[model samples]
Target chain A: MMTARAAFAAVAFAALALPASAITVVVADGAPEIALRVGATGGTISQVSFAVAAATAGTGTLILGTTNAAAGSAQAPNFGTACAGNNVRIWARARSTAFSPRTATLTVNGSGNLTSGANTIPLTNFGWVTSGGTEIASGNFTGSPTQALLSFGTTREVSVCKRFQFLNTTIYPSGTYTGQVTYSLQMP
Target chain B: MNPTRLLASLALGAAILATAGPVHAEQPATDTTAPFAVNARLNFRLTYPRFLRFRVGATGATVNLMSFTVPAGNVGSGTPVAPTGGDAGGGTGVNVLVYGNNGQVTITATNSSGGLGIGTATASDGRINYNQISSVSSSGQLPAPVLTNAGGTTALPTLNSTLVTQRTAVWTYSYLNQTIPSAGTYGGTNASRGGRVTYTATMP
Candidate 1:
């Protein structure tokens, strides 16, 4: 009877053997992600102008410049897309166009996005910074060009198109005659 | 099976008992975790002026002054002022700094944050321009500023220690820049002017 009992336990253990080929499957949310390129491309100016540079004997003039130009591209809106997008906008401001005050009329032209209703927006960021302090550019993103009907006061860097232009003079004074205002726009 | 039956099945029961034994532990293994990272970062602030302003005194003034750091970091030997275009002037030698060089000195930047490592290494050279401006007239003022590269070049800084110290090393220098005053509304006399310098620090 005892032998029979032992034999029954052995049979039960053999019946409990599990399968070896089956694989357990699991499901869960993977990992987190981040984006590096978040902003749009194109015009990056709100205003543009010129300055005295200095009261030098031979006064000099400046030509509007663009950054990220398409390598060997030419003309006003020749700037290359460091990254691409259609949102281009720009603007120009002035201090005074008077030659003596070291000012000049600044004409701006660029590609990309522009004004919806009007083609131009004038600037008043001319003259010495302390003389007339103003915020030249802001909230710039994709398309639009700015023009300065006022004066290009001192020797300053103007945000023309999507780059900076350094206008200067020295015949008159050695101090920095900074004047200029330009803005840019692009997809944020 | 009964204990007696199991023992009878053993081939060398007496030998097994003589050669083998069972040992068990009462306690479980405790978790000992370690800290590790794939990458680290250094944290610090870059505080410097956008533009430096200097005064060209009535009489030519000379003191320790600075200049803008060039696009490549060429210690301004005598380059155009900032905003390199428009009216002001270039080659007028107004923003030139006559440096008293002392060779390239060693500079180090360290990050005490996560990495506890050196962030960047740089070299500082000592030199300043002492410019003498002769004219400030309208037609072509700044008569003629003579720049004599004065002061001996500085020597390289000692960097025997590692940059992990968590600080920055900057080589201090002195240079002179001059400006011939414009014919004033007051007197027919001419005065001298001075300049200022500024720089920014970056690390990787």
Candidate 2:
């Protein structure tokens, strides 16, 4: 009886050993997102700052969009007056995740427009800079929101800035101009 | 290999395995910046006041034609005089001065019978027997006159041009008290023979 019991116990031990033989890998899924805070509104004479944190792992795309559809480089609530200095800037920091250096694409929606009622300040007024620190592209917003604005092949900071310039001030009327913008970070 | 020791060892190993990494693999972790609202604002304003005026002479003063009596023997005769900024009646001519933009002055006979009738016209009540007599000049200002002697509704000349600035127009009047039956008072009241000429100025 004792001999029989020992054999049965050995069989049970083998079953448990099978699962323990494999290694366990601890991992964390994506976490809840943190908010990007832009402390103040933009204006004709001054520029504003906006910042976002780096991703934990993997490659992703960052998208920026606007509600108005005006066709110029200056974003909406347009410096309707065509004042001397107006603009926007965006920047990204170097990635801390060195092992999985994944490429990041920065894109802006063509629909990005700054609008006040029926009036709009265009998205083309904005420009982008890569981690190397030079303007890669400049001009008006395109016809689609899915348009690519910039690409990051390495883990580095990137930026975009806008400068609205108007040589003539005689055409604009006096009134309050106002509008809104949206952003997205996506991976596929 | 005691039974109790064997059972205890197995239980401990099971607990260790349970405390290890997740049994099911999870997707690679991702970090994102939440969506945010962007906004912007601007401010604007303008002012101008109201004005208009018209006079009948170089003195820039309004004038009323003075009353005058003609002898019965001169009933069929006509008279003409230059209006020198005064109420001197009997065919006195007057200079008209107007200052205003985009406005016109229209003169019409407002009498029930329309205007002075032609002495020989078949119908006697609606015609004015008169002529433009004289004007400053065609170059100074264009004159539009509908003055006639045939009996009918009479709307005198009208300055149809829109005035961009102040302007002056001058003209002489010739009055003929044609043989129209009774030689009663022939001026002043709108209903009387020659009656009054109503000048209306409008701007839009």
Candidate 3:
């Protein structure tokens, strides 16, 4: 009788093992989510002007002019009033949590021309000088027609500062000149 | 196939379902690629001056200083006085209207003859010698005038750092009253002796 009980116990263990195969093991995730934070948008670059009277003669590039009197002298606007800490701040991050590497790149596009009536000023006349804490390389828009602003091997956060610099000039038509620069961030 | 065999099969199926837990919790892997976008734009504008008008008196047609008594003497030397201000004279002040959207205007003065002249009696004699009569002090609306030189180039800040609206620059004249020329009406319509001092406007 004891021998018969041991054989029945073996049969029950085999039946449990058969059901184990029927149990499906499935792994899943909630959903793929990402986040990007860039400072204020819309006319991100401020309005700039030049005064011919105060402008000094320069051989290379044209810049905003300086003057003795406060009236109508050409000087760079205080960009900080509008931007974070007076400089452009760009930040981005992702939460794959899957340990998957993600990429984010920044690109700029525009005619690179500042216009007033028929007059035009090239975008190259001005530049972006990196300031304060920065993760990306320091360079100007003329060189960065399309370049990587930031990238990461995993989830990360970063911040940077950018200041706009104008070249000194002697000549350019007497008019209000304007130009545009576009920044695009892409992630996949 | 007896009742005991059927019961054993049913028990195995029940255990499998129980161990599986919530069926909805398990989800198959899906497409993981997603592209997101954000835009940054730049908009700037400038409104240049519509017309840069220089006028004398309270207002009137633009005119040059005319009809002055020639100092006596062949060498053009006399204790004669300087030319007086006009209705729109620098003494009274002239209005320079710079219509624009932003900032100041840079003004420069240049003479074609190198000096104020009537083809014969040159203000600089042969160079740029002319004084600007202005009421506003350097510390005021306009900077001190840098008188024109013999080379037709005047000192900068001719009207340096002027506001976008309208301001006055008065006018009067003093010439080296020496070596008076052959007496005749020095100027008339389209006379070459009527040297012109060109004023240019630009944003610095």
Q: Estimate each model's TM-score.
A: 0.14, 0.28, 0.38
| Alpha-carbon lDDT of model 2 | 0.34
User: Rank by DockQ, descending?
Assistant: 3, 2, 1
Residue B137 error for model 2, in Å? 7.5
lDDT tens readout by residue for model 3, B1-204: 889999999999999987653211111111234764443443434333333443333445555443355545423554434444345443333344332323455556654544554554444344222432122332344332444434233222233223233344444444445444554544333435544555565543
User: Number of clashes in every candidate structure?
Assistant: 108, 24, 31
Q: What's chain A's TM-score in each predicted model?
A: 0.18, 0.39, 0.56
The model with the greatest TM-score is 3
lDDT of 1 by residue, B1-204 (tens): 988888886857877785442111111111111110011111111111122121222114442222322333333344333422112234221322111111222222221212211111111211122332112322221112222223112222222122111111222222212222222121011111112222212211
Report the CAPRI category for model 3: incorrect
lDDT of 1 by residue, A16-116 (tens): 42212111111121121111010122222112222322222112343222223331121122112131111112222122123423322332222231121
C-alpha RMSD over true interface residues, model 3 = 11.3
lDDT accuracy of residue A179 in candidate 3 = 68
Name the TM-score of candidate 2. Answer: 0.28
Chain B TM-score (model 2 vs. true structure): 0.43
